[model samples]
Target: MATPVLSAERLAASYTYHAYRQLIDDLQAEGKTTGPQQSELLTNYTRLNVQRMHRLDKTVQLLPELREALAALRKPYVWLIITEGWCGDAAQIVPVLEAVAQASAGNITTHFLLRDDNLDLMDQYLTAGGRSIPKLVVLDAATLTEVANWGPRPATAQQMFLDLKSQDLPFEEFSTQLHGWYAKDKTQSTQRELLALLKSL
Candidate 1:
């Protein structure tokens, strides 16, 4: 089956990094924020992750290798992210991605589409048969062809989740351990995996 072409104009109309930050702020101000599959606890966690990512956006410095890789890109591409305001993983990963796009020196443009509102696009990039949030889909701007994709979480974190799943732990315990892993990671695994994806492309 052929990969579906995502609408660039739609993506352009979607949130920019700054706009996404603003949306998160607005949602928090409303005293409520919830996605399709999120519970109250997850919603609260997502808010916290958004705040953490905002801080990271200000302080995240690219390593030398990543800098060189981003700097070397000559072809134009779109780093299209599918996410929602109440997705904790998206909050953690999106800002790091935004920082990378900024360092690309205009070779790449990053945009975000809310997954709930874009089911067609979301279905094209499902993770493990599930609609995982914070999916990063790289598209060639000129042709709108999807070149690569990465998402949900880094391999290390995903493995941790699978291990936790095998134990059939309670949702509260599972989420606490999962997010604690993300807290300690500091986006290193995310950056490393994305850098690898960029190199392959």
Candidate 2:
């Protein structure tokens, strides 16, 4: 079997980062989110995610090493991100990705696709047998071949989540601690990991 590739038509139908952000905002205004299921909890998460994204968009600063790696790119890449508005991890990480692509100085372009709307694609990039949001599929611009991928969360964060899960903590408690970790880390772990990823590529 061949490695599945994203069709150009699919890429064309995906949202730009700005458009994705706006879509989330628009949905939140209507007390909704980005999937088939609708509920107050999801809506509240969507609202909170909007705020998280807004803050990261304005406040995220790329590390110098990551900035250099991004700036040194010789070829262009497309970062197709799988995400949904109600996802807490996506809220914490997507804006930082946009910031990295923007700093790439045309070497990277980003497109966003909702996981629910793109299950065929999402299934190909599952993390731990689960459809994890904010999963990135980096594609070579010319060939549309996948080059590298990263995401859902940094390794440390993922470990923390797994540890919390092992303890059988309630969703509310674990989520609060996770967000607190993100706030304290301030994107450093994410930046370092991506910096290494870029160097390897």
TM-score of each: 0.91, 0.97
Best-fitting candidate, scored by lDDT:
2
Model 1 over residues 10-85: C-alpha lDDT tens digits? 7668888888777767777765564456466656876787777878877777778898999878798898889887
**Model 2 spans > 4 angstroms off:** 1-4
Clashes of 2: 0
TM-score of 1: 0.91
Cand. 1 Cα-lDDT: 0.82
Q: Candidate 2, residue 21: CA error in Å?
A: 0.6
In model 2, state the lDDT of residue 134: 89
Q: Name the regions of candidate 1 deviating beyond 4 angstroms.
A: 1-4, 34-39
Give candidate 1's error at residue 72 in angstroms.
1.0
Error of 1 at 121 (Å): 0.8
- What residue pairs are clashing in model 2? none
